[model samples]
Target: MRPKITFFDTKPYDKEIYKPLAEKMGFDVRFVFYHLTEDNILLAQDADVVVIFVNDILNEKVINKLHSYGVKLIALRCAGFNNVDIKAAKDKIKVVRVPAYSPSAIAEHTVALMLSLNRKIHRAYFRTRDANFSLNGLMGYNLNGKTAGVIGTGKIGKSLIKILKGFEMDVLAYDPFPDNKLAESLGYQYTDLDTLFQKSDVISLNCPLTRETKWLIDKDAIDMMKEGVMIINTGRGKLIKTTDLIEGLKAGKVSAAGLDVYEEENEFFFEDLSDQVLEDDVLARLLTFNNVIVTSHQAFFTKEAFMNIANTTLNNIKDFCEGKELKNEVKI
Candidate 1:
């Protein structure tokens, strides 16, 4: 019999792609839009496997509950698995992830956010729609001569560096295990976090979310940044401090912000909350800024990325059920 898999936090698009993919892979997929919580842990009671997303809470309690019900594996569709308590799942509930579904899909969207924020394209389009063609406060700086700081030089970061280089921007990257061969070929300079922050005209975050990376861009880090800097985050949200970013934006220390993720995104993103009054104060304030561009964490929402995610998720489940060694198991 095919293993029963409970999929949590599924959107319509996710359902559209994964339903067919799961069928093709012969998975007994049970869809649940509810986030994984103590109350909903029973939802996976009958399933042999559980598939989760970023917003789902899979803590010790949840894992133990699932284990009690004889769940064997936890498969993650996204690259980052910070949401899952890997230590708790270790030895008991096996964990795996789709490490690289489509790096370029996210990389291209990172550049898209950077462009839209820097050039005020979203604002310009809205103004033009209303027939207001004035150039007041719409000036944008050229990217050609600017320096771009890349936090992580992984697949997505490497892809982003190539795009920035195409615009002739000097690239500075920081990674504990820097890919010297890739940097040598791509002409990217490796630098410390302080130097990258102080000199970069544009900074893009492409790193994973871990204990070391949480709140990487805090108040003091922002203080070290050059004034009028543009910051973009296409990676994990908690990497940036929401309040600190807001403070920087207000002080003109940060010229613009293009975020595809948010620190308090659990309550707001992946759903339409336009009609309701937003209870999240920081997100509400971000909407008021013309220089800030928030895109509902859609950096990985492209067709190519979705397809790759679907395939990888199905394969992860397949590999686990087949008693094969899980490929992308997290150390912690």
Candidate 2:
């Protein structure tokens, strides 16, 4: 019998991409529109593998239930695993993820957000739609000579640095594991967080959400930044504290913000909520700011990235079924 795989939190795009691939890969795949939560944990009762996205709640209880139901593998389609309880699933069930699908997809989206925020594209587009062609309040700074500070020197960060360099911006990066050679080759500097925060005209968060990096951009960090600095986040949302960011925007310490993720976005994103009133006070308040741009976590939604995710994920399950070493397995 083919290995049984149950995919949760599936959208139309996910089904469009994965269903055809599953047939080619010879796996018995099932797609569920609902997310994998504590209440829906038993949905994967008869499956050998459980596939999930970022929004799925895979805490200790959920993982324990999956284990009890004979689910051997927990596969994540996205790179971030902060939502999963890796420690709890350590011995009971193996976890794997597509560490990277397309670094350029996210890297390009990061630059897109920066350019949109800097050039006031969103505001200008809306103004033009209203038949107003005036350029008032649309002033934008040149990125050619300005400094860009990038957090995290991973694949996506490196890709972003290349693009920033192409725009002739002086780049400063901060990471615990620094690559001096890459920085030198790319004509960028790797500096301490304080120095990067103080000097950068535009700051971009491209790091993972870890214990040390959670709320990395709180009040104190904002205070260290340059006045009227542009902030862009394409990484994990909790990397910044929403309340602190609001305070910064109100005080004019941060001139603009572009967010592709939110700390409390699991309940809101990936769904059509246009008809419903937004009950999230912080999110509603954020929309009131003209200088802020909040996207529904679509930085990695490119076709190339989705294809890579589908291919890698199915192959990961295939390798497990064939008793091969799980190269993408998450180690606790």
Candidate 3:
């Protein structure tokens, strides 16, 4: 019998992509519209593998429930694994993820957010739609001589650095495990967080969400930054404290912000909330700012990234079924 796989938190696009991929891989697949939750854990009772996305909550209870149901593997389609409790699933189930489906997809989106925020493209487009061709308050600074501070020098960060360098911007990066060789070749410097914040004209968050990195851009950090600095985030949401960011924006310490993710985004993103009033006060307040640009988490929504996620997830399932070493498995 082919291995049985149940995919949760599935959207129409997910089914459109994964169904054919599963057929090619010769696996029995089930797609669940509802996300994996305590109440829906039973849905995967007969499956050999469970596939999930970032929004699924796989805590200790969920892991234990899956173990009881004979589910052997947990495959994540996205890179960030903060949503999963690796320690709880350590001995009970194997967890694997697509660590790098398309770094360029996210990197390019990061740059797009920066450019749009800097040039006031969103405001310009709206004004033109209203038959107002005036260029008032649309002035943007040149990136040619500005310094860009990048947090995290991983694949995505490195890719963004290359783009920033192309614009002749001086780049400063910070990573616990800095790749000095790469820095030397790319013409960027690795510096401490304080120095980066104090000197950079624009700061981009591209790091993972860890205990140390949670709320990395807090009030104190914001106070250290240059006045009228531009802030961009394409990484995990909690990497920045939403309340602190709002304070910075209100005080004019941060001139503008381009955010692709929100700390509480799991509640609003990937769904249509237009018909409903936003109950989240913080998010509603963010929309009121003309200098802020917020996009639903879509940095990795490109066709290339989606295809790579589908292929890698199927391959991960295949490897497990064949008793091969799970190279992408997360170690607790």
Candidate 4:
């Protein structure tokens, strides 16, 4: 019998992409549209492997339940694994992930968000459609000479720096382990977080969410930033405290915010809730601010990215099934 793989939180795109790949690779695949929660963990009982996306919940309780059902591997089709309980699955089931599907996809989206917010392109499009061509409230500053503070020098951050360099923008980056050589070669400098906050005209968060990085931007961090600074987050939502960001917007401390992620986004993201009333008060409040552009966490949504994710994820599962070395295994 072929090894069965069950994919949770499956979307139409996932079925379109993964179905063909799994058939060619000779694996039995199941697509579950809803997220993987403890309540629905039984759906994975017959699966030899379980595939999950960013929003799937795999807590200790759920991991234990999967182990009881004989699931051997947990394959994450995306890069981030913060939602999974790595410690709980360490002994029971091996876990692997597609680490770098398409860093450029996210980096490009980051710049897109910045440009849209800065030039008020979103507003301009709507106004023109309504036959109102006045440029009132549409003035925007040039980005050529502005300083951009980029947090975390990972692949995505480095890609963003390259794009910013193309725009002739001065770049300031902050990372716990700074690469002086990379910085010098990229025409950027690594600095401390406080300095980055105070000096930057634009602050972009591209760091991973860890114990140290959770709530990295809060009241105090916002207080240190330059007045009217633009903030962009393509990283984890928890990187910035949403309530503090709302307050910053209210006080005009932050001129604009371009967010592809939100702290409490799991409840609403990747789902169509237009027909239903939004009950998330913090998220609802954010939508009211004209200066804020809240996307549905689509920074990594591109054709190239989706292809890379599907191929890499399938290879991860194949390696585990064939008893080959799990090169992408997430070890505690």
Better of 1 and 4 by TM-score: 4
Candidate 2's error at 15, in angstroms? 0.8
Off by over 4 Å in 3: none
Give the range of the ten consecutive residues with the poorest summed lDDT in model 2: 36-45
Q: TM-score for all predictions? A: 0.98, 0.99, 0.99, 0.99
lDDT of each: 0.89, 0.95, 0.94, 0.94
Which regions in candidate 1 have their CA more than 4 angstroms from the true location? none
Residue-wise C-alpha lDDT for candidate 1, range 172-274, written one tens digit per residue: 9999999999999999999999999999999999999888999999899999999899999999899999899999999999999999999889777888877
In model 2, pairs of residues that clash are none
Error of 2 at 32 (Å): 0.4
The C-alpha RMSD in Å for every predicted model, in order, reads 1.1, 0.7, 0.8, 0.8
For the record, the alpha-carbon RMSD of candidate 3 to the native fold, in angstroms, is: 0.8
User: What is the Cα-based lDDT of residue 255 in candidate 2?
Assistant: 99
How much lDDT does candidate 2 score? 0.95
Predicted candidate 2 versus true structure: per-residue lDDT over 260-289, tens digit per residue: 999999999999999999999999999999
Clash count for each candidate, listed in order shown:
0, 0, 0, 0
Report the candidate with higher TM-score, 1 versus 2: 2
RMSD of 2: 0.7
Off by over 4 Å in 4: none
